[model samples]
Target: MLFTPTVIKNLLKKPATRLYPFTVREPFPNYRGELYIDIDACIFCGTCARKCPSQCIEVDKEQGLWSCDPHACVYCGICRDTCPTKCLHMKDVHRKPMTERIMMVEKGEPPKPKKKAAEAAPKAEAEPKADDADKGESKKADAKKK
Candidate 1:
């Protein structure tokens, strides 16, 4: 309560600074820094975009995707909770630079899970039989006649 000189001096010590761009300080566990949506896992649900209090989330349901303007976010973290797939999260990143205000929109079906070569061993071994190979009885009859 008392504005003592000693207390004031202690508080003024360079004020914690992050070296940003060169070195990023990881945000606290609960710190809502920036929103990131895992488009691959997203089900195209509009819950996140709809629940946004600031209306900063942009989701195109018909196009099956979503994105948000980094500048417009208030870092409220509402979208993260509203996401059904839990695809949305507040990543450990601070406000972006002025030159990077917009987020790139990524759309399309998620990459199919790769089938390991070992799993496909059976298919590779099963080669199609040629027509000549299938006519074994006819070839035997012709050879006996000759």
Candidate 2:
């Protein structure tokens, strides 16, 4: 048969199917797989948590805490879409399987920028105080000329 070469080539090639744990197929560009939060950009506004249909997200603005349940999330991406700061991300990578039911929580504040000592020193003591002396000398010189 003329199909003999095609059959031989297909047989020699690797199988299309792969073991899941060993190899993961790349997710499509639009796949909504998991949630990621950029804590610094987040204003502790509670908007995303309020918009979640499943109520998986919990925010305590007073305590500066954010918590989410991965098991409870449906990956519908409503929270990501509603974020005012666009701090939430619906990534294409799936959440890893977990044996325990644990709340994913992040707390506290974003790190503050450090003030430079060199900049502070220049601000405090850089004035020359020579203008007043220059003005007095100029007045004496003018009186002498008169």
Candidate with the greatest lDDT versus the true structure? 2
RMSD of 2: 22.7
Please report how far candidate 1 places residue 124 from its true position, in Å: 46
Instruction: List model 1 lDDT by residue over 1-146, tens digit each.
Output: 57698688988887567676787776688878867777888876567666777766656544565777677778888888778889887766566557645674768463332477646643442332233234545856887999
* Model 2: pairs clashing at backbone N, Cα or C within 3 Å: none
How many clashing residue pairs appear in each of the predictions shown? 0, 0
Model 1 ranges with Cα > 4 A deviation:
1-26, 110-146
Q: Write down the TM-score of every candidate.
A: 0.55, 0.62
lDDT of 2 by residue, 1-146 (tens): 99999999999999868998889888899999889888878777678776888767877654668889899899999989889889899888888888988888988573332466656643442343244336546966997999
> Candidate 2: what lDDT?
0.76
